[model samples]
Target: MIKKEDDFFSDMYQSINRAFADVIKEFGGFEISKKGFGFNPNFDIKEAEHDYVIKAELSGMDEKDVEISVEENLLKISGEKKEEISDKKGKYHVSERKFGSFERSFTLPPEIDSSKIKASFSKGVLSIHLPKNEKANTKKIEIKTE
Candidate 1:
């Protein structure tokens, strides 16, 4: 029941959608590593008695481009990196660093207080501090009933 005009418009819609996605990539902030590229975000995730800490090296990303979210026990980090110069034209000598959308995640412990987590971005690094819940911080002592 689809008409030719409807099909044409649908194709247009898809094209426009792709353009918008490009715009998002340009300004949306960090680029996740492309498939088959052996590069990762390069982060350090560590656990302490209180909570877990994550440090990520996002060298070229601004504050607005990175997105961090925690759902249940999963912590997600996503962002885009805007290439310094896009006017490649025809002059290219060396291209090494990869650029695009990137995402990383860690499995957080159940005791983490996601709501109270603190994040600070400086230079090209993003440091996050997650504090444990009060109950998780205290040691439990079992009492024997005689």
Candidate 2:
């Protein structure tokens, strides 16, 4: 079922939106789904006593499929998830799983010690530990009233 409207502005807006989405698609910015555009995996960051911990959900991906690196103040995590293939081909259903390459980068704070960072991936979860440097560690300063 399709409904056409005589609204010129709305039609122009839709055309612009589609063109923008096409550009994004060309650059692998996101994957268009029924709901909307989806980008990257879900992740969470937590600040601890001496380190900042980042955990990203990367289910169904092996360690060999993932890569992590740090340059300047940016930590990059990139990987590819291969799509599964079934021997018997019969398609007429809903397919929502995302299978492709993805890269995610985070700009770390200046207080982080890049040299002593640690990363571990286990059970579909990628965890990163960024220890704070001595200068960036918590310090107590005395207040002087003049």
Candidate 3:
């Protein structure tokens, strides 16, 4: 049995509202989610006595395509992934991989030496190691009597 036109319209209206809400939340900022398509809003960061380590999972990506950088206390990760398969051509199939440019930024501690940061990508993971500045080490003090 077919439903009434008003009922169908109401359902469509709700769906549209939810889609709009998603865009607003994405643009205005919202809590991070690990599911579905979209950028990873948050990444795991750890701090050691000697360095600040940042690691992110980026599967189906090549090491040559990623770019990592830090400016002052901010760190940014960006990359583009393409959709290509070497063999088998067909239509009407399930595809769940995301392909596009992604960017993520984080504010690091003041003691991190941005110039000394090292980045490496391996086995579908990207790691950034920011070693503490040379000044972070203890300095000698001189006592003077006047």
Top candidate when judged by TM-score against the true structure = 2
Winner by lDDT between candidate 3 and candidate 1: 1
**lDDT digits (tens) for residues 1-146 of candidate 3:** 43433556546766776777798798996634322133342367887778878888888788887888777688878877766665656553444455666777788778888878888889888888989887776567999999
In candidate 2, clashing pairs total 0
Per-residue alpha-carbon lDDT of candidate 2 for residues 9-127, written as tens digits (9 for 90 to 100): 54676677788889899998984422212225788999986899999888988889889999999999888887787876676365556666778789999989999999999999999
Q: How close is candidate 3 to the true structure, as a TM-score?
A: 0.61
lDDT of the candidates, in the order given:
0.76, 0.80, 0.71
Per-residue C-alpha lDDT of model 1 across residues 1-146, encoded as one tens digit per residue: 32433456546766776777777799975543232122246799787888878898888788788899988888888888766777747755555565567788788888888899988899989989999998999787999999
Q: What is the TM-score of each candidate against the true structure?
A: 0.63, 0.68, 0.61
Predict model 2's lDDT versus the native: 0.80
Clashing pairs in 3: none
Residue 26 CA displacement from its true place in model 3, Å: 20
Candidate 1 residue spans exceeding 4 A from truth: 1-39, 86-90, 138-146
C-alpha displacement of 13 in model 3, angstroms? 15
